[model samples]
Target: MKITHYLYNAFLIESGDKKLAVDPGGLMFYYFRFSPLIPKSEWNNVTHIFVTHGDPDHYWHADRMAAVSKAPVICNKTMVQEIDGKYLLLGPRDKGVAFTTEFKNHHKLSVDETIEVDGVTITGIKTTHGPLTVKLGPFSKTLNPGRDERIGWGAIGFKIQLDGKTLVNLGDTLLHKDEWESIDSPDVLMIPIGGNAVHNTMDIPEALQAIRIMKPKLVIPCHYNCPAFFSKNFNHADEDEFRNELEAMDIQYAILHKGDSIHV
Candidate 1:
């Protein structure tokens, strides 16, 4: 199996006849310029798409990619609403908390629920996206996750089993030790470690705690040192320090830059 990183939490996992796109989002805050993380060239070949939440950095281009590739999207059940016999997805580009977007092929699962789609098995895992605090100049605003807010709407992780291997991707979430105790010894784990500064996802220390619980073979840290607003490294982290600690713990890890890939 081959895994490719496209910055933030966007990734492409390829094995046999399946190509899975995880969180195929766009670069947020660059309104004048549009930049897609997964790249337009790779859209047509995507077999499936997975979304962890409805944040713009993780879901901006999901509908477009799903439309182009004709791939089924798997997300938390809260992201969709069945109204008038039509399942409407939370609008990827809607103003706020509106289910205006609809995908022809989609699957919604609650936490701890499992589903099989096109020969792949997927299980939804519990997660919580922390409150996001945005700052501009002298003003700051914090958005908390709630029924009416969009900070971390539909936040959930994924445990994907395919080609005789288990891969876990925890999209921007805080540490949920009790909820994630059941996930044991995955082949690969993609976790976020940039929340120390922004208080959104798990920080490096929290991510290490999760690694000890899950005991994955290979760990890939994400959502750190990303571009946002006017800063090139909005969610900053010291990956080298993280690597040293992992080494002391005898855990294998990969620090992937944008467009980097690792084979397992």
Candidate 2:
């Protein structure tokens, strides 16, 4: 099996006749500026696309890629409704964003459901997106304090079984203990190592704890080190620090740059 990283959480996995792309959103400035890590020409071979949530950075290029490749989009129910047959408006909240010229079909998967598409077995796993807090102008408010928020658009993780190998991609999530029992040990585990301290996703320490719990043979750190347009200073979590922690735990990991590929 071969896996290629396309910056942030976007990845392409190829094994035998199957080609699956996960979280193909790459057009926004929060993730990338002008071009995708993997060019448009490389997307033609994609057979299936998986989206973890409704976040713009993760769903931006999904429709476009699906239109060209005619690949079915696998995503959460809400995300499927958001872009089912309508053009996507890309921008800040309420200001209206740019729209895509194409539309594609979306397949919604709930947590704990398994589906087979294009020779790949995909199972959705439950995940949380942390506390909900929003900032408006100079004021910040907690929209989901106490028990109001339900974790970032009902987010989910993916357990992909292909070519006799099991791979798990935990979208943006907080470290939850229950998920360990639900998912089997994976050959490759892709997780987010940023935003734990900030209450949006798992930070380095929490991610290390998750690594210990999942016990995957290979671990890949993602959802960090991308450019942010709203802020003047670009903030990124350190993969080297994550590597050091992983080494201390005797866990194997691969730190991939944008567009880097590895075969396992």
For every candidate in turn, the CA RMSD to the true structure comes to: 0.9, 4.5
Taking all chains together, the TM-score of candidate 2 against the true structure is 0.81
Off by over 4 Å in 2: 27-37, 81-104, 131-151, 230-235
Model 1 local distance difference test score: 0.93
lDDT of 2 by residue, 169-258 (tens): 988788887766766569999998767434667888888878778888999998776655454222258877888888988888899977
lDDT for residue 29 in candidate 2, whole number 0-100: 60
- Model 1 clash pairs are none
List candidate 1 segments past 4 Å from native: 31-34
Models 1 onward score TM values of: 0.98, 0.81
**lDDT score for candidate 2 against the true structure:** 0.72
